[model samples]
Target: MKYLVTGTAGFIGFHVALYLLNRGESVVGVDNINDYYDVNLKYQRLAECGIDRGNVSDNKKAVSSKYPEYSFYKMDLADKAVLMDIFEKEKIDVVINLAAQAGVRYSLTNPDAYITANIQSFLNILEACRAYPVKHLVYASSSSVYGANTKMPFSTSDNIDHPVSLYAATKKSNELMAHTYSHLFNIPTTGLRFFTVYGPWGRPDMALFLFIQAIEKGQPIQVFNHGKMKRDFTYIDDIVEGIIRVADRPAKPNPEWTGQDPDPGSSYAPFKVYNIGNSQPVELMDYIGALEKAMGKEAIKNMLPLQPGDVPSTYADVTDLKRDTGYQPQTSVEDGVAKFVAWYKKSYGK
Candidate 1:
């Protein structure tokens, strides 16, 4: 089957594409490669897929040498014309949309970016899927959507109406838009609400990468909420595995779904939502200690108040995912951090 995987230059997308390629599946990867963080890191990821960084230009297409069945294109989902063209040409069987303007704090400063990338771009993707009916449409949601909820082990069945950040709001909107498509056109849509995903080749903007960089440079690492934060730090490999499993299984209508007693997780249409997370919440201090162990250096700490649009803790209830896909996030924080540190040292020649 031919897959169209967006955000090919991103950490998760790169890993997912590599996994599919290794399994001898054909993939047409797409990315705008925006300079949201480090463009060099994005280029490095593309290079791993055998795409020459020098050869990539706006809207250009290239093939990978490492995996002959894999190809890539520099395109934005907001560009409906280009997106539609690709869909028409590639004859894509399945689509995995992972591209977006991703930082919560950044959204506070640049709200328009989220509107264009997350909202507009996502609508374009939905339209394309409607026009060219694919087998399945799998997209990324966030645990941030559970904003303002103090519930333990956040569940898909919980209400996500009160989002603390614009970024989170957009993700919730994506879920709504997906449900509309599924209801209107019978498109098989699945939304995966990812928790704190971290591992090798991770985004520099993420906490794990920032902490590792600061600790390595002997700089003080900022501890938000006075180190009272807790997260379900899921490993990248586990996330990719869950994604592939879901991609293979198209969503089915919930026969028991009724307007009287509605479950937010499923619908009468072919729409579903699942929490893809470690299902284990670790304290912030413990995560830092694990990083210190991996780097062999104690980090100078700078305790600070929690910033706006930030949640103190996040714990996911991945019961639905496990029930459906037999999914289990097996990587422990210690092992995951060690693997990330090793990759960081090797990548930067520290």
Candidate 2:
């Protein structure tokens, strides 16, 4: 199937596009390549995907040098006219919308970016999918939507009405907006609520990346909640695998669904949401120790209280994911961190 994967320069999107190309699928990738973090890292990821950084220009297609089946374009999702043009030209069968303004703390300072990148961009994606009628629409959601919930193993069925951050609120808004399209237009929409994704080529703002950078410079790594937090850190490969699996299977009306007692995760329409995460929750201190072991150096850590808009813990219940797609996350935190450290050292020449 022909695929349109947005955010091709971003961490997860780059990996997904590369995986699809490697497996002999035609993929059209698009990313704004904004300097939200290091644009150089974004360029490097695109280069790895065989997209020449110099060839990239807004609203223009650049065919991959290495993969004949892969092509990429530099575009923002907020541009509906341009997005619709691509949908018409490419005849995309499946769309994986992975682009967004991606930080919880950043959203606290810059709420407008969240609205533009997350909400407006997603609306355009929904519109494109509605106009084009793709087989499946798989988009990224986040475990941050589980904000203010004290429940263990945050489930898709849980009501995520109490979002603590604007980023989480926007993600939740995506799910809601998707459901509307699914109901009104019969668009098959699946929202994957990703838990702490980390690996090689991870975003610079991510906790793992921050920790490694600080440790390498002998700076103190800030440990939030006095290092007493827990996170369900799923590796990037696992997330990509889950995306492919879910994309292959279009959402169907849940026969068990009822309006009397509504399930937030599923609907009478072709809409569903699943938590894609490692079932195991790792302690913050243990995660740091694993990184230290991988890098062969102890880190100087500064214990700090949980910052605003930060949740102390996140654990995902992936029951629906496994039941539907037989999806399972294989990499342990130790192995994953080791692999990331190896990549980081090699890439940074440290």
Candidate 3:
């Protein structure tokens, strides 16, 4: 099967592309390679896919030496014409749209970025899917969509109407947009609500990365909510597995779905939402402890109140995902943190 994976240079996207490529599947990957974090890390991910960063051009294709079946392009999903053209040319069977303007705190500072990348770009993707009619379209959603809901172990069935941040709102918007497409065009769409995903080649802005960096540099690591937060920190590999499984299976109309009492997770239309998480929530302090162990260093702590647009806790109830795709996040915080620190050391030449 030929798959088109957006944000191939991203943490999750890179892992997903690698997984598919390792399975001997043909993949057409795309990424804008924005400077949201470090473009060098993005380039390094491309390098791992055997894409020569020196040869990269706008919308230009590059082949992978390690996985000859894999090819990549430097493109933004916001470019409707280019995205549509790629869809038409690639004859893409499945699309895993991971590209987006990520970061909740950043959204507060730069709302336009969220509007352009998350909202506008997603509309383009939806339109492309509607026009081209792919078998399955799996896009990245977030646990943040749960927003102000204080419910423990958030279920997909729960209403995600109250979003705390623009980023969360945009993700929720993607789900709604996808549902509309599924309803109107009969396009199968699956949205995966990812939790705090962390592993090798993770994003620098994320908690794990920041904590590691601060600890290594002997700088103070900010502990939000005074280390009173709990998160369903999932491994990247597990998230990728769930994504691939869902992508392989096109969403089907829920047979039991009724207009009288609609299920938010499933619909009469070919649309579904699943929470891809560890099902285990870890405390912020415990996570920090794990990080300290991994790095063998003590962190200079700066405990602070929860930032605006930030949640105190996030726990995903992935029962539906397990039922549908046999998805389970196996990596514990201890194991996961050790692996990340190991990768960080090697990647940074420490």
Candidate 4:
């Protein structure tokens, strides 16, 4: 099946698109290549898939020279006219929506970016899917949606009405909007609530990348929540593997689901939500220590309080994913951090 994977230049999208292309499946990639992080990094990801930067232009499709099965477009999801045109022309079978303005703390100041990118852009994707009619629509959600819940292992069965950050609020809103589309239009929508994903070609804005950068430069890295926080840090390859497995199976109506006691994950409509995480929570200090070990340099740590819109810990209960898809995340923090540091050193020539 042909797949239109948005955010193709992104860390996850690049990996996912490559996986599909390598499997001999057709893949169409989309990304605005915005300067949310390093634009050079984004371009390099595209180059890795054999897409020449010189051949790429705004809203125009460019096929990978090495992998002819893969094509890419530099288009913003918010642009309804252009997006609709691509949907109309491409005959896309499935859509994996990973494009978004990511960063919880960044949302604290730039509220409008979240509205435009996450809310508006996702709405556009749903509408396009409705119009074009794809077999399945898999979109990225976040573990941040489980805000204010002191639960040890966050499960999809629990309520997600409370969100601390506007970023998280928009993600929860995406799930709601997807549910509405599924119920009203019978769109097979599956929402994947990703945990702290880290690996090679990871986002520079993420904590792992930031800490690694600071350590390499001999600068002090800020240890948030006084290094007391915990996270279910997933590896990128593991995430892509789970994404493909989930995408291969379209969501179906749960016959057992009733209004008397509804399941937050599955419904009578063609909708489902699953957490794509390691299911293993590691402390922030432990993560840093792992990074230090990987890089062979101890980081100068500046301990600080937890910022607003930040949760002290996140642990995903991926029981539903495991049961339905046989999903098992295998990377430990130490191994994942080592892989990331190796990639960082190679990419930066450090």
Question: Candidate 1 lDDT, tens digit per residue, 11-103?
Answer: 899999999999999999999999898999999999999999888888878988788898899988899999999999999999999999999
Task: Flag the better candidate by lDDT, 2 or 3.
Answer: 2
Local distance difference test, per candidate? Answer: 0.95, 0.95, 0.92, 0.95
Q: Give per-residue lDDT, candidate 1, residue 184.
A: 98
1 or 3, greater by lDDT: 1
Predicted candidate 4 versus true structure: per-residue lDDT over 125-241, tens digit per residue: 999999999999999999999989997799999998889999999999999999999999999999999999999999999999899889888999999999999999999989999
lDDT of 4 at 76: 94
| Candidate 2 segments whose C-alpha is farther than 4 A from its true place | none
* RMSD for each of the candidates: 0.7, 0.6, 0.8, 0.7
For candidate 3, the per-residue lDDT at 256 reads 98
Q: Model 2, range 1-350, lDDT digits (tens) per residue?
A: 89999999999999999999999999999999998999999999999988998898989999989998889999989999999999999999999999999999999899999999999999999999988899999999999999999999899989899999999999999999999999999999999999999999999999999999999999999999999999999999999999999999999999999999999999999999999999899999999999999988999989999999999999999998999998989999999999999999999998
Candidate 3 displacement at residue 294 in angstroms: 1.3
